[model samples]
Target: MTGGPATPPTPRPPLGPELEVRRLGRFDYARARDLQQELVAQRAAGEVCDQLLLLEHPEVVTLGRRTPEGAADGLDLPLVEIERGGEATWHGPGQLVAYPLFLLPLGRRDLHAYLRDLEEVVLRTLADLGVEGERREGLTGVWAGGHKVCSIGVAVRRWVTWHGLALNVSNDLAGFERFRPCGLEPGVMGRVADLAEVPADDPLLEAHLERHVRGVFGHR
Candidate 1:
């Protein structure tokens, strides 16, 4: 019941020479962030392979490092400034957050390229469900029509990366109304259920997301 009707059980990619997956649920951003920092330190010390920490954050609006003043204009939600890159966005239950901690060689640290690959993972998942999407110019997420279906904001240090993307599954967008999502034009946020014309809890949707994620990062 993981992959949707259109999604096949695709083969997982080999995580090259270093990669790990830490499955967690219902975790807060603060704890997740702490784990990310710890994992980064571990990788630096060669104590563990690069890892992907998956979890859901409590309802919160996070403003990234480069976010400008008023980027969250008109939003009344609880806000927290974090170490990630990009503008402001919301995270809550029902949404899936992925934090990939990897070490890229100095010149190999391409943040833009990394973001595109992450977007493609979501886009491909959506495509399998007959939902076509594209990357908008000057924007950092996957979009269906004009609504943002996935949000991307990442951070990099010395060629290592942490804090990845968030995809709205069945989360309440009402909370999104409290802010201009990712500092985009108001009302630009969206969910998979909204575009797929199906319930977010549909067994197929969950399966597809999990499979797609495994597929995306399976290759280290």
Candidate 2:
């Protein structure tokens, strides 16, 4: 008897440049920012491939380009002023932060498109974990169950991108109460663990994220 029609081979994700994925557990915010700067320079010089640094930070509040002066004046958390495009935001132990040090080619250099691709990567990863994520109109993050679950802020230098999105895994949401995050009310922040059972440092979640990044950003 003839066998049933064979299934088509799984189509591979489209490839662009190579990406090196690194996992740095509980890194300091300042150090991480410095590292991104160093990598950006190297990537721009054609001395390194694309890089995706995934990690968590201790309790900290960061001010972006849109943050007004003194926006974080009273926050007890460590405050950092950064060059990324966004407002004030928080990062802590239970959050997963990703910094993509990529030297964008001519085709992928559109800042708006890059932001959307980052959102798409998060949406796909959340779907894999059984959570539905959507983008709000005029907002640049992933929300679920009517609350913001991801915050994205990025900067590009010499066409190289750095500083990226933060996903709340099992992080302490209470920290958000001390200050406005992403220019939204503190109550707007949400955690993935609230909707599903996943650790902040889950390896499987990181793997899913890597796959999504590769697919969405066209990195091999």
On lDDT, the leading prediction is 2
Residue 73, candidate 1: C-alpha displacement in angstroms: 7.3
TM per prediction: 0.81, 0.90
| lDDT digits (tens) for residues 1-220 of candidate 1 | 0012122233333344555767687887778888888888887677887777777788888999877898776666667899887778889987878787877654445566667667877888788778888877677778886688788888876556888888887788887776667776658888877766654454225445556655655543
Tens digits of per-residue lDDT, candidate 2, 1-220, equal: 0111112123333336699988998999999999999999999998989999999998889999999777778777788889999999999987889999888776566677777778888889889879998877678888998899999999999999999999988888998997788888999999888887774456436777888999877786
Report the Cα lDDT for candidate 2. Answer: 0.83
Any runs in candidate 1 off by more than 4 Å, and if so which? 1-18, 70-76, 197-220
Q: For each candidate, what is the lDDT?
A: 0.72, 0.83
RMSD of 1: 6.4
Worst 10 residues of 1 by lDDT: 1-10
* Residue 169 lDDT in candidate 1: 72
Give me the displacement of residue 58 in model 2, in angstroms. Answer: 0.9
Model 2 segments more than 4 A misplaced: 1-15, 199-204
